[model samples]
Target: MALTSIIAIYALFWVMSAFVLLPFGIKTHDEAGLPKVPGQADSAPANFRPGRVLIRATIIAVVLTTLWVLNYTYGWIGVDAINIFEKPEHLKR
Candidate 1:
């Protein structure tokens, strides 16, 4: 793939990774035994850390992007491997 294509793919993976890890390792004010402000939402995080989330998301995105690049280069998994609309060749008459 071209350099730009790889960069786009990595960016997509990074955003997805960040969203997937958003809810993990989070603690609400109630859970952390911290009193919430009058206007604060009940689900607001008490110790949300963007740095940690970014670091974790970066690591996950790197791993996923590496596998995706390898797969694109090596054809380890192809379109046919995940085609679920039709029966597989082996299962078809």
Candidate 2:
């Protein structure tokens, strides 16, 4: 794959990882024994750490992207393997 394609794919994976990891490790004010400020939403996290979240998301994305790249390079699973409707020539006999 091209360099740009790899970068684009990685970026997509990073964004997806961020969203998937957002709710994890979160603590609402009530859960953390912190008093909520007036007008604060009930679901809002008491301690939001952007840096930590970003780091975790990056790690997750890297692992996923590495596996994806390896699969692409080695063809561990190919298009034919996923084509459920089509039978291989040998199997069609």
Candidate 3:
């Protein structure tokens, strides 16, 4: 059940990203300026930089992924609050 839920969440991410994010121009690369490669003409717009929307979306996705991982393994809010690495010697059975 847990594994299935995780898979579903990831599936939802792709679905949401395609239908939701792509519409608003949340592109992976620069829209106006193409990235410079070796021995290439600078044909793209020089004034353009990475979009703020993409950056914010990426950050939000990472944060949510971390939270999901924490919730799955420890059933907690965050990973830092749960000391899963600390051994409880009494449970050595």
Candidate 4:
């Protein structure tokens, strides 16, 4: 539960949030009835608003980081919950 750890976690969440939310509010040139530049990529967005993406990513990262911090604090979901390769204690015998 160190400050650096929290900051790192937040940064990781922020990047993930940004990437996952990137395509959500976007539209291709064709989708938006906009003309494309010469040789532009087919998937380019007509409206690429970095500011909107930034805001949404920030909010998602905050919520996710908070939940992660809470989980770290309370041990609500432990490593064993998702460790599929190893046999649990009761089954080890």
Best by TM-score: 1
Per-residue lDDT of 7-82 in model 1, one digit per residue for the tens? 9999999999999999998999999999999999999999999999999999999999999999999999999889
Off by over 4 Å in 2: 86-93
For model 2, what is the alpha-carbon lDDT of residue 32? 100
All candidates: TM-score: 0.91, 0.86, 0.33, 0.84
Q: Any runs in candidate 1 off by more than 4 Å, and if so which?
A: none
Give residue 22's error in model 4 in angstroms: 1.0
lDDT of 1: 0.94
Estimate, for each residue in 1-90, the C-alpha lDDT of model 2 and write its tens digit. Answer: 788878888899999999988888889999999998999899999888989989998998889888888899999999888998988789
Q: What is the alpha-carbon lDDT for the whole of candidate 4?
A: 0.95
C-alpha RMSD of each candidate structure in angstroms: 1.3, 2.3, 11.9, 2.2
Model 3, CA-based lDDT: 0.57
Q: Which stretches of candidate 4 lie over 4 Å from their true place?
A: 86-93
TM-score of 4: 0.84
Weakest lDDT window of 10 consecutive positions for candidate 3: 21-30
TM-score for model 1? 0.91
Sort by lDDT, top down from the best:
4, 1, 2, 3
Q: Which sections of candidate 3 miss by over 4 Å? A: 1-50, 77-93
